[model samples]
Every structure is written in structure tokens, then in C-alpha cells.
Target: MKVHFIAIGGSAMHNLAIALHKKGFEVTGSDDVLFEPSASRLGKYGILPAQTGWLPEKITPQLDAVILGMHARVDNPELLKAQELGIKIYSYPDYIYEQSKDKNRVVIGGSHGKTTITSMILHALQQAGKNFDYLVGAQLEGFDTMVKLTQEAPVIIIEGDEYLASPIDRRPKFHIYKADVGVISGIAWDHINVFPTFDNYIDQFRIFAETIQPGGELIYSETDEVLKTMVDGLSVDVNKLPYSLPEYTIYNGITSVLYSGKSYPLQIFGQHNLLNMEAARLVCQNLGIGQADFYTYLQTFKGAARRLEVVGKNDNATIFKDFAHSPSKLTATIQAVKSQFPNRPLIACIELHTFSSLNKEFLDEYAGTMDAADEAIVFIDRKTFGQKKIEPYPAEVVKNAFANERLLFFNEPALLLNHLEQLNIANSNLLMMSSGNFGGINLIELKNILL
Candidate 1:
């Protein structure tokens, strides 16, 4: 089969193209801009466009299918051409569903901890020597591609993001999967730009729950009261499994899960992660994996990239990074590190990067989120506001919104880096959180200095 990709430079789009190419499909893709990893990887596969930018010629009817990325616009030349030719077009999630329609689909969905839970199941499955098609959000250690497609793999584990499927398709991506097994890690009002109100944001999860195939299973975190209420009165045909933090204790900075008073050491830590593990364990059980085997293999799971990832560390200090921009995520991450190293000073730094997080109204949601840290710092670029065509917010505005009188804010990268450099690293742990680079700060270089 042959497939053409429109706007293939996206992280997920390029990865899907690579997966299809590896599966022996003819893959051709075009994008106006292509960056490092995606560009290099596509070039290695000899599928990189000889020249970048959309080409009408590439969308001919001869192509078997056209997969559209969320980055592409409705007016994109190639997409318009494909539409003119009546070519079959599929959104990334739409195509994923098409590929796995015959197989059992396991979707991991929620506002928080979905990636970690999904990664955990993938790790466990890989370790148990199981062959399964999968699509996860992060670049995992053992998996080469974020997406893998195979005809023989009987099951597919998907990280079901609740974001819009495509420019033309407004439906949430997870809702399109129609999962045979579904998991809701937790509920938090996020993506305010799209959903606008808290109720609207929550309604998406409710829809996702209702979309589970008949007789399918839904595994959810009981810790989130909002989520609890959402799944409370679901139809009787759909099975519901609620999970919580398994009894575990941290000793000398190591977290171990306790089963029948026997402790099993874990490579990962934090109560949130432990809770995510419980959700993952339940999903694995549905996939025919036993409880003992799941725990046995999960002990070696390091975690997904940028989910409280330890980038650098030393005897006196450690530097970690995470993809946490939302209020719930920020609070959970800060609390996790503080609990993990109670004696050490915790420096919590975050960047107001996304459209919702940068909005003046959304700033107050962060109140008390960084309170657990010895020092709390927020960085945002005034230039970002200019680029986004939004009103510029002063440092004091952000400081006031957070309601932390001691909170420090920076509008420039250099100033932020300078402030961090001046702090004494003794007996401290640095937790950097953002979905964007902190105004182009080189984390690896920063880690070198801290370590």
C-alpha cells in the first residue's frame, strides 16, 4: 500500500510515517518545515521530500491514501488537491484506528498521567516478550519508534490524547479510537483554549467513556473525584475498574510496592507514578498478562521521556525535567519531588509556554502549586506574547496571579539562567517543568553545570 502525508514534520506524524515505512508500505510525505530528528530519520529512509513545502503534484490520485497531520491547515495546497481528487484522507488517529480496527484496542486516556501509564504497559509488554502494535506519546528506551504497526500483533496499546484530531476533524482523538479497553488516569481541566470552560473540558472525558465498545473494560483512577463522578453511572455492559495508589513506601529515596507485606523495589518513584502503575497493571491484565509477571517486568521500567526524567545528578544536587504545564500536572510533579527528597531543598522552575498557560486568567490556577518547593520560579517570554498576538503580561502580573509573594518571575532567558546559576546547589533538587524550552535554554548544558 502507498500513503502520502501532508505536514509530516510533526513528531507524531513523522514517527507514523517511519512506522508505516518499516512495515513495507510506500510512504511519501511533505511539510513546509522539517527539523532535526524527523528530518534526519526521514532522510535515512529515503522518503524525505527532495524539497520541503507542499506540492500539489504529490497529491495525485495515484496515491492510495493521504494521512493528514494536525499541523496542516484546511487550505494547504496538497490537502486541497487530495480533496479535489476525492482521495481517501485520514487523520493520524483516524489512520491508527483503521489499522487496528480488527485487533483489540487498548486506549490510555486522561488529563494527567496518561503517557506514564501507557508507557508502563508498553514496557511491561515488551519485557514479557509479547508482540503487539503500539503507539505511545514519548520516545521510550526500548522502542525505536513512538508508533508501531503490524498485521500479526493481536492487540494495540495507544496513548489516547484528548486533543483535537485534525484541523478538519474537531472530535477528540481518543473518541475516534473506540477502544476495546480504556483507561482514565485522572481528570483535570486543561486545553482551556479549545474547551473554554471547565465543564466543557470535562465533557470530553465523559464522551470518551461512553465511546468504549460494547462489553469493553474501563480502568480509571479513583483518586480524582471528577473522574469518579464521570464514570459512576455508566451503562451496565461496560466493565469499570477503579485503581488507586498501591500500598508502597519510600526508603532512602527508593519507592517499593508492597504486596502481602513483601516489598518489590521499583526503578521509578512518586505516589502519582505508583497510582499510574496501578492503572497500567489493570490494563495489562486485560491484555492477558498475569499480576505477578506484570510486576516482575515493570520493576525495570525507567519511565517515559520528560516525565520527571532525571537529566543530571550528583551527590549534592540533581536536575530533572518534565512535560508539565497544566495546574494538576505541575502540582503533582512538585509534590512528588518534595516527598522523594524531603530533606533537600527543592527548586521548582516552570515556563508559561502554551496558549492556555500564558493566558492571564489561567495563571491563578497555579496558586500553591509551587508552594512545596524551597524556591519557586516562573519564566515567560514577553516576545512570545508578541508572536502569539496576545496581550503582554508583566512579571508582577504572573507573580500576583500565582499568589506566592515569594515567587520569582522572569521575562528573559538569560536572566532566568543567571538567577538559577547564582543559587547554591548544595542539598537541592532542581525540577524544571514546561511543555516548551525555557526561552531556548539548553537543558543539557544547564545539567552539566548543576551536576
Candidate 2:
């Protein structure tokens, strides 16, 4: 098969391109601008474009299909050429569905826990010696690529994202999967730039429920009231399985799950992760894996990358970097770190980097979300405001929006780092949370300084 990717230097797009290349397909891609990891990885695979910009001439009739990335504009030259040639075009998610249509698709969806749930399922399936293909968002410990497609695998585990599929296809990525078994971990309003309204954002999940194949099942988090309410109103014929945080105990900063007269220690902690584990377990059960087998495999699961990952630690201090930019994710991550090390003071720092996080209207949603930390800090790069074409908010506005009297906000990275360096972190835990880099702050350097 021959496949060409437009704007292929994206995180997911590059991974998909590599997966296809490894699958014995002739892969070619073009991107106007390629970043560090993607550029290097693609070069290693020998699939990197000769030049950086799109060449419409590369879109030929001989091409089997064009995989479009969200990074590409609607008027992208290569895309226009492909359309002119009457060639089939597939969005990243659409192409994934095309490959997995014949297989039992287990899609892990929701605003927050999709990556963790998908990673958990992959870990358990690998441990059970199950042959399966998977597409997880984050890089896992054992996985080389975020996407895999093979003809022999009977099932495909997909970390279903609710974001728009492509520039042309505005539908959420998960909507195209038509999952055989789906899991909604939780629903919080996000992607305000795309969905615009909270109700509009939620309707996407409702559509996802309706997209499940006949006789399929939906595993949901019962603890999330909004998700539970949505599940209750689901008119789909598929069976609904609800899961919550399992029985667990934390001892000396380690968490363990008690099940079936056995105690299984977990490398991952936090109520949110436990809920994710339960959802993954139910999905595994539906896939024919027993409860015992699931627990046994889950013990070795460290966690998905950047989802509360411990980057550095010492006897008295630990530093964690998490991909938590939204309100709910920030709250959960902060609370998790605080709960795990109750004796240690917590310094929670978050970057308001996302479009929603930077928007003045959405700022109020973060109120009290960082209350678990002894010290709460918010960082928003002033340059980001200009890049996003949004008005820069005052530090006082952010402080007021969070409603935390002790909250400190910084529009400059140096000042933020200075404040952090001046802190007495000697018996404290530092949790740095953001979907973006903390304004080019090297986490490793920060960790070394704190530790």
C-alpha cells in the first residue's frame, strides 16, 4: 500500500506514518515545519521529506491514500492536489477506523483518562500474551510507536481523543471509530476553541455513545457525575458497565489495590488513576481476561508518560511533571501528589498554556482547583498571549479567577523559576503540571535544583 501524509510532523501523525512504514507500506509525508522529535524520528525511518514545505506535485494518482493531519490547513496545497486527482483522503482517525473496522475496537474515551486507560489495557493485554493492535496517545514504556496496525490482531485498543479529526473533518476523532467496546473515563468541558460551549462540548460524547456498534458495551466512571448522567441518558442498545475507585490503601507513599483476597501493589497512585484502572479492568474483562490476570499485569504498570510521571526524586523531595492543563486535570494531579505524601508540604505549579486555560472567560473554571497544595503557583508566558492572538491577562485577574488568596502568578519564566528556587522545598513535593513546556524551563534542571 502507498500512503502519503499531509502535515505529517505532528505527534500522532508522525507516529502513524512510522507505524505504516513498519507495516510494509510505502510511506511518504510532507510538513511545512518539523520539530525536534518528529523530524529526527522520521529521518531515522528514512521517510523524512527532502524539503520542509508541501509539494503539491507529490500528490500523484499512484498514491493509494492521503492521510491528513490537523496541522494542515483546509487549503493545503497537497490536499488540494489529492482532491483534484480524485484520490481518497483519510483523517488520522478515519484511517485508523479503516484499518480496524474488521477487528473488535476497544476505544478508551473521555476528557482526561483516555491515555492512562488505553495504556493500562495495552499493558495487561501484553502480559496476557494477547495479540492486539493499539493506538495510545502517549508513549508507553514498552511501545515504540503510539500507533500499531496488524492484520493478525483480533482487537485494536484505541485512545479515543475528542479533539477535531482534521482541518476539513471537524468531527471529534472518537466519533469515527464506531467502537465495539467503549469507555468514557470522565467528561469535563474542554477545547473551548472548538466546541465553544460546555453543553456543545458534552454533546460530542453523547454522539460517541451513539456511535458504538450494535451489541457493543460502554464502560464508564460512575464517580464522575457528569459522565454518569450522560451514560444514564444514553439511548444506545449497548450494555453499560459503571466502575469507580476500587478498594485501596496507601502505606508509606505506596498504593495497593485489594481484590479477591489478594493485595496487589501499584506503581501508579491517586483516585483518578484507580478509577482509570477499574475502567481498563472492565474493558479487559469484556475482552475475556479474568480479574486475577488483569490485577497481576496492572501491578507492573508504571503509568503513561507525563501523566503524573516522577522525573526526579530524593529522600526528602520528589518532583513530578504532568500533562495537566485543564481545570479538572490540574485539580486531580495536585490532589494526588498531596495525598500521596501527606507529611510533606506540596508546591504545585501549573502553566496556563492551552487556549482554554488562557481565555479570560474560562479562567474562572480553575477556582479552588489548586487548593490541595500548600503553595499554589500559576505561570502563563506573556508571549503565548501574542502567539495565540488573545489579550494578555493581568496577574491579579488570574489570582482572582483561581480564588486562592495565596496564589502567585507569573508571566515570565525567570521570575517563576526564581520564586521556585527561593522556596524551602527541603521536605516538600513539587508537582509541575502543564500540557506545554513551562516556558522553555528544562524540567530536569528544575528537578536537580529542587532536589
User: What clash pairs does model 2 have?
Assistant: none
Tens digits of per-residue lDDT, candidate 1, 1-451, equal 9999998889899999999999999999999999978899899888898898889998887899999999999999999999999999999999999999999999999999988999999999988888899998889998888999999999999999999999999999999999999999988888888999999988899899889999999999988999898889665468999998888888998888988656788988888899999999998888778887788888899989999999888887889999999989999999899888888999999998888888888888888888888899998876888887789877788778888889999989999999887777778999999998888889898877766
Worst 10 residues of 1 by lDDT: 229-238
Local distance difference test values of all predictions, in order: 0.90, 0.92
Q: Which lDDT tens digits does candidate 2 get at residues 173-267?
A: 99999999999989999999999999999899999999999999999988989988888988888999999889999999999999999999999
Looking at model 1, residue 446 earns an lDDT score of 82
**Index of the highest-lDDT prediction:** 2
Q: Which stretches of candidate 1 lie over 4 Å from their true place?
A: none
